[model samples]
Target: MIATYSGDTMGTSWSLQAVAARLSVVRGVQAALDRIVAQMSQWERESDLSRFNRAAPGAWHAIPNEFADVVDAALMIRRASDGAFDPCLGALTERWGFGARGSVDRVPQHADNGGDNRQIDFDPQNRRIRRSVDAFLDLSGIAKGYGVDLAAEWLLANGVRHFLLEVGGELRAEGIRPDGQPWWVDTEVPPSSSLAPWRMALHDSSAATSGNYRRGFTVDGRRYSHSFDPRTGQPIVNGVSSVTVLHRSCMIADGWATALTVLGPQAAISLADAQKLAVCVIVGDREYISRPWRDMLG
Candidate 1:
């Protein structure tokens, strides 16, 4: 029998299922996830991330090892995606009313276009980070994926080999189910569609999906998506509806999903192909699959 447990974290729910059933193990997993939220949640005022966002500029601040790891991943992806995905868009996110502080009445002026990820400095040796500009660091795009990974790690350490771990919509599956089958997941068809959902099997891999379909608002007949282009400080008007990425690390899959969504379908497809990443991009009624992702599906 697979043991299952779930709770709230990072403004979303997290669920875990393992082959080993133990209350102690479940509590430990919950604790591990809670620690991640305490350290990385931008929505929580007392979170380490929030404190870092409000810290004085030009001074290096010590960070938790896990936090530093996520930052390092974000910076690497930022370079790989050519700024399509950025963690330094906190100011722009807030200006667009997508921040922890909530929404505002009108679009704020885009003065500085926020700052680039290059402005932030990371010292992996000491797990320290410092920001040169006034930009607020937001890890919402990638932190939850780390949370999922942490939960999975805890289960593995507890000797639970076959499991599926999910935080919010991000997920990672390891080994096989009790019935000796791979964990299967379904990709939702874009909103307002009558089409059947696409299905994929996960084996020792992670998947994350990013889209503007459910989280945008209309202002004066103009639609503004929650996703913003870090380079322009403006909402992306790209034709792509959603992007799903599969990787060995949930954190990388999560960040790449958002990055590819921002890049739109064509550019996203090209990058996914070049990187040999498994990705599925949905544009309008059409779906595009990268070579790696196609192999996975087959």
Candidate 2:
């Protein structure tokens, strides 16, 4: 018997279901996701990588496997984006008032002390993390997509051949929907009365959107977005409203969305082409394009 549970998890609506001969497996998967969240949330704070606001210097100590996994993903995106997308933006993120705490009236511009590329010491053998710089990290870039992927894996492992998993709007689809159609989701846009939402379909793929339009603030006549440029320690003022990436894994899609959001359309497109990655970026006024979006959907 398959069972389903729908509730708020990680500050967003989520549902999990599974197809096992016995009903208990679905419940188990839900419990598993919940447990992972509980553990990751704590690791996000105590880990040295999250050094925003109050993260003490010299606290770059080894953490557990969960923290290691997030660091691993962040490092991947950092290298992929040539340091455009980084985990070390925690201090910069909070400096611009985008962390667990809110804004400050003023912040110092980032000092280019060659501190950006400070290597994080992660002993995979020991599953620990160490950092040489006084940096802060935020897994917000990759965590949701990683969580969604984990849930999808859990369901598929339990014989759920058809399902959709979403966390904080990052999504993944596997097999088929119950109705026997490819799982489709709209490319979400700001709700303007004059504009209609863009839609896309998915089949055994993942998609994620990162945007300043959805989450941001203004202070002293300056606008700030949640997407922090780890390189500059400043909010990106790019005209792009949103960038969505489609990829094989929800984790990669989520990370690339943030990376390309920072990169904006032109540069992002260049990098995506160079890497042969599938991506779509939506700028303000609904102008958008993805070179391989049509082909990827097919």
Candidate 3:
């Protein structure tokens, strides 16, 4: 029998389903996620990430292995996406009123990217990071995915072979259900929209969805998305509602979902095709699915 458990982390909720695993494993799983938040959360003033962000320019600070892993993946995706998935955009995000400072009705004024101030050099081999300027590193795009993966890792190490794990809306599935069926999940669509949910059967795979509808504020009838274009240092004006990405690593899926969302529909399709990413992009009810998405669904 599988036991279900859930708690909170990363300013969101986490849930798990384990087949033939001890209930006490929940404590270990929770601890694993807590470790990630302790090191990565900018919301926590004392978190390693927060301390690093507040340090002097050119100062190198030691980071935990968990933080380094996310940074490595983020830097790889940033290069692969040509800065569309920049982890170094925390300052821009805050300028757009989406970072640790919280939301605002009026958009904040800032020059575009301010030329090199939003840059970071991470040394994963030494588990350290250096800021070229006063840069804030934000991982809102991918840290939740890492928490999901780490929780699943804890479960696997504790003898759980069959399970599905989730933090916020990001998901990772392993093995099959007790009935020998893959975990079936549906991608989230904007509320009150005429969009159909995209469903998939997941086993040993992960999925993450990024949508403009999740966070933002409306001013003068214009809905400002929390999604900031790192290239422009402004909130993206793209018409995209959401992008869902499927991959073996939830962290990559999460980052790619955000990257593709910033790239918008047509551009995202091209990049998804080139990367062989299984992705579905929704723009005001117009659904665009890549070849990999179609192939994976079939």
**Local distance difference test scores for all models:** 0.84, 0.69, 0.86
**Better model by TM-score: candidate 1 vs candidate 3:** 3
Give the worst 10-residue stretch by lDDT in candidate 1: 109-118
Off by over 4 Å in 2: 1-4, 16-29, 42-62, 103-118, 192-196
Candidate 3 has a TM-score of 0.96
| Poorly placed runs, candidate 1 (over 4 Å) | 112-118
Shift of residue 3 alpha carbon in model 2, Å: 6.7
Residue 182, candidate 2: Cα error in Å is 1.0
Q: Between which residue pairs do clashes occur in model 1?
A: none
State the lDDT at 220 in candidate 1: 82
lDDT of 2 by residue, 113-229 (tens): 434454565577777666555555567788778778777777777767776667778878777656667776887675542345657778889888886777667668876777866
| Root-mean-square deviation of candidate 2 | 3.5
RMSD of each: 1.6, 3.5, 1.3
Candidate 2, residue 260: how far the Cα is off, in Å: 0.5
Candidate 1 lDDT score relative to the true structure = 0.84
Per-residue accuracy of model 3 over 106-139 as CA lDDT, tens digit each: 8676576443677788887798889877467899
Q: Which candidate has the highest TM-score of all?
A: 3
* Model 1 per-residue lDDT tens digits across residues 1-298: 8888777776678787778667777687778888887898778889898898888888999999889999999999999999898888777777778888788766666565434443788898999999866568888888888888888888788788898888878989999998999999897567865556678888999999887786777778888889888877778898778888899999999999989989988899999999999998988878888999888656
lDDT of 2 at 37: 63
